[model samples]
Target chain A: MKKEKLNIKAALTLATTALLGCHNLAQAEPTEKDSWEFDAAFLFYSEVDRVSAGEAIFNAKKTFEDEDVLNLKLTIDALTGASANGAVAQPTVQTFTRPSGNGQYQVEPGETPLDDTFHDTRVQLNGQWTQPVSSNLTASSGVHISKEYDYLSLGLNGNLAVDFDRKNSTFLLGFSYFQDTFTPEGGIPNPLISMLIGDRNAPTWDDDFAKTRLGSEDDKTTADILLGFTQVINRRMLMQFNYSYSTVDGYLNDPFKIVSIVDINGVTQDNIYESRPDSRVKQSLYAQSMYHFDNVVLDVSYRYMWDDWEIESHTIDSRFRIPMGDSLGKESYLQPHFRFYQQSAADFYRPFLLEENALPTFVSADYRIGEMAAFTVGLKYGMLVNDGNELAFRLEYYHQTPTDAGFEEPGVLNDVELYPTIDAVIVQVTYSF
Target chain B: MKTKFKLTLLVPLIVSATGCASLGVEPWERDLLAKDEMSLNASPVDSALDDHIYFSKEASSGGKSFGGGGCGCN
Candidate 1:
């Protein structure tokens, strides 16, 4: 009787364990790979006759049985080719000193000035730790360091996520801070200082002027905070919204950028280093939705951003994923992506300064800060291989079109190409296991 | 200098987002939602690289995640 009772107890325990295990397995989707996982990708970006870049990124993650996770990432970027120097086109051949002040480059008549020495390699490293603070709360923190030929940046961030309403909703709060330093070649240019043109060769070059033109290195700091909410509207749809606020202070000028000092006829007279406000605040609101269908998934997002510089922007992006026939049963799909962006010019944006007008306290000629509309069209395909591993490739095209300066173009300047459209192509390949 | 934060502005936002748990189904009904691509950030690396490219080319950045690895590109 004793032996029979023991057998019965063992049988009941076995049945209970089997029942729970079977149900859990049926309800659980595979979200984590065994032990460790890696993701790596290579990107190629090229702009028509302007700039080109090659970049690679590698990411590794380890998951513990307890649900704690660790992640590390490395990024390497190699950039080469010419970049716009924020100078308007001229009817006559133009020559200007390079950022180094030790050299010069020439632009042909009716052509925009581009600095040909634009080149740099950057490397960044990042690490993050995530763990559950409670059944419904998770915390994550990370640190990143990046270095370039003439720049360095260090940053730290932390985030907290709380699940409510029986895990149907999640609220997240995050903050990050960064400190960056600049060590541009030949030192930082003094704001509003007139640049000496080919001083070593110019007949009227003055040594005294060079002494007052530059300063030592400079730095800047930025702080950002974000609040986010994510909710599952139904089994087939999910939505997320976020609000972000950021502040930046310290030296804000691009040491290499200069503004053209032009005369009444919009003819080049001299060049002066540009200046910008030492502080700025920016805010943005973002919303996204993802919906799944029987054979396809659709994702769409939008963002509205504004800043102290009086710059406002709007962005709309969408992606549609359609699965291929019998391609690992929905594991393989083709995705089409589209994005459109538009921005208003900043308060300090200037295509060129009028020699007769009094100088402003803050000014910049960078076209990036001017009114512009941009769009991107892309296609991506992904397939499953080696059982659960994945391989994907994408190709995209981007175009930027700038609006009229609205300032009257004087003399021959009206015939010059003031705002040239930028066209670029991007290709990428990624692998994950 | 404007648009300062106020609790009054958030009161309605929070109220509208909460008390909607009834919209969800039982735990067993989450099979479809559990798919890997269903996550908000299904592909982190893809997002990161795209952010870097746009940040360098555009005047406005950051409607997504943040942690500056900034460069003097402009």
Candidate 2:
């Protein structure tokens, strides 16, 4: 039986090679056709009063004749700091359950609520290969895996492109699928359950705390499809358009987030885990254009997106690159970028629930699903050396704001700000050869 | 919603139809466009890092590459 299995595997491998093999392999010499390239970058990202992260990435690629290529990449990230727990601030000290639902903590009066137990490291690896099936057709495939302290993700993707109109235009189709597993440190908490703490006045611990499992895991899956077109409109201009659709299912809730419950007078009552729909379908249309002039180039793109969760968004990105005088026989350029984004809230998003209203089937306080807008401004400088090496640096400032959802205001807490502004900065350096 | 869907379908057709006007230049004029600096993604590594950052902080993703999904943070 083992011999038969081995034979079957061999046959399958042979068949796959034959199907994807180069049509003109005999015309190319391996040593003459292959060239190596490498890129490395370090990133620092920080947000006010929230998580901060530092990351580094290294990528290596080998290019063969006809633009065929193989790539390998490694990424590492370290994250630390505090994140909001979606609870409201009040005049009295407030206590809430921890993520594990087994421990509790307190926030001082008139202070924003935050959970400081956020620290983790992540590592991700990716591999991809591209090959030309013919002079006008190409195929590419890739796989990636990422691991964190409480999460794991594995995914695969493939793309096909065909050139026509003398290579002035191309059509592309791509598909991707991913599977993810999550095992929160304290296990997944039941949605909308009042945080358990020892008897109210005695500050005793709940007996059920010991029963919470630390090894439970939840799974999520996502599938995506994209159709794209690229055209060279003029010698100095190019344009591209793409339409993409994606669907996600299973365990869509954030295990660490919770919502505050308020009484008729806006007095804080309890805090419970947030809940959300288990599935979502989303679609987007994107268009991009690039134009070059005597001393500069312009790049611009726009995207419109909507989803079944009743959220809609628009994004615009624009950049201008200006060439500077040559330095030491190397070309140098400076680029400035501006980006804008706005999004509507999801149907189930709320700042806080009222005890007088009917219990909601789905509810969440996660600010990401709330109405918001963000703007980014950045500058980058790059240089190309005589030996074909490249070096670049970028600095950016980002600001995000949350807006009202146009819902009825709570009678007593109408003055409270449900969302706080977030300000962040990013710095990056990249080198390639 | 239906009208938005229709517009999404129509915009692409209109853009492609305009191509029939033959507004493109001859092959020799492509010299400038052939330069690496003129490409849409001149810095692939930098673009990848930017994409990752936006995905983690925002509610929407995609338009460039694919396959990486939600992190535990989301």
Candidate 3:
């Protein structure tokens, strides 16, 4: 009887162990089912004297078997601003007389200031869709449409990505196409005028000059391609590199601006409309790396860029995020940042033009001339607002200086050095759930 | 401009691919990368505002992203 009782107890223990194992297996959570999620945001921004801009954004995403399957994004933006109109004192012709045998004309110059203002607005819409073909393959496509004043643009872009080595290595190919058209605010019928009076009795104005209005209609097309790589060196380090090239073709000039004409006697005459290169090619190489330590994060980046228009630039950016407090509490940090930037001038950049010299095929009096430098400092603070929420804020200031190449005339109009130094303040806020 | 665009696309692809190949992080290591602040553009609104200011005051353009409305200031 004792043996049988012991055998019965052993059998019961085995059965109980088996039953518990099955129960635990049955209680395990089922593999997560495929799911979809949606998110949306609205942003509004305004500049003191410029315009107010707003955007509405919507995003939808879905995942299957723990992998992203599809994503759709849309954005609509609107910008409205008052016309930037200002008046400048200019000389007006009163009359002209020729002196006997002097071969020179005497003229009267009257000063006048004209006042003008404008109203401008624009709207743009963009849509993007992405789909995963396999565990390691994905494709994305996008389209955009915009309208401003008399200008319109339509664009399309697409990209394909393939992953390798368990999603650590990825290869991507992309293409983009853009078509744009522009029409000036005023109808074309304006007349062109010369500074010097050649034939007083003949018609010196033509329709072509009138048709080339400020902000006139223009057509343009652009295409681009890119390649990139990213790597996680260690638990505390990461890095990435990228290369890109692009081409742009079409009317690429400011029709509103005029080139000054000077007489042999060093006197200014009427201004003539100017034109620029119709096409441009640009390329860039960029690399970035980050290192995270126990108490701080160090970031650095470099970019080399060049263009067929004789413009080249090198940019080096670095930042360090250091934790300052939280000795008594968790999740408290403060970071201060600094940035510096510099760039070379464009080929067509010129401070002033001489009357006796032959003008180049393309020329510009715009003052983004020579070399430039900028410095920025900022601070960020982060802390938990509550059990389920966090809050962060950032504030920054920036300043810049002109290069030695500077402007043609130090104190004169179009002189690069005379341009006022830039000063700006930026603030950001973020709340998360 | 065209070459710049191409370079932008090429660089991103090459970097992403190389990163994938060299990455050895376990699934749990992605906690930081999955954070919203890890994105290149932390605030789209602020970025857009900065771009607008730069476009109005400078000669260079097309750094933030693609597709923007036309402005007479240019």
Query: What TM-score does each model's chain B reach against the true chain B?
Result: 0.60, 0.62, 0.59
Off by over 4 Å in 3: A1-119, A187-216, A261-268, A318-337, A368-371, A380-394, A398-407, A410-418, A427-433, B1-23, B26-34, B39-73
DockQ-best of 2 and 3: 2
User: Which candidate order results from sorting by DockQ in descending order?
Assistant: 1, 2, 3
Look at candidate 1 and give me any clashing residue pairs: none
Question: Can you give the DockQ of every candidate in the order shown?
Answer: 0.46, 0.44, 0.15
Q: How many Å off is the CA of A34 in candidate 3? A: 7.9
lDDT against the true structure, per candidate, is: 0.83, 0.81, 0.53
Q: Identify the CAPRI category of the predicted complex in candidate 2.
A: acceptable
Model 1 bad stretches (over 4 Å): A1-34, A201-209, A327-330, B1-22, B67-69
Error (Å) of candidate 3 at residue A13 is 53
Model 3: DockQ score: 0.15
Q: Whose TM-score is greatest here?
A: 1
Deviation of model 2 at A334, angstroms? 1.0
TM-score-better candidate, 2 vs 3: 2
Q: Candidate 2 residues A1-433, lDDT tens each?
A: 5466445434533443355473443432335355456788999999988889998998877676667788878899999988888887666778876776545788877666888778889999888999999989999999989999999999999999998887888899999998999998778777877656555334335446534332478989999999998889988899989999999998888888888889877778888778899999889999999999887999999999899999999999988998876852368888899999999999999988987777798998888889999999999988875355677889999998978788565544665556788899999998775
lDDT top scorer: 1
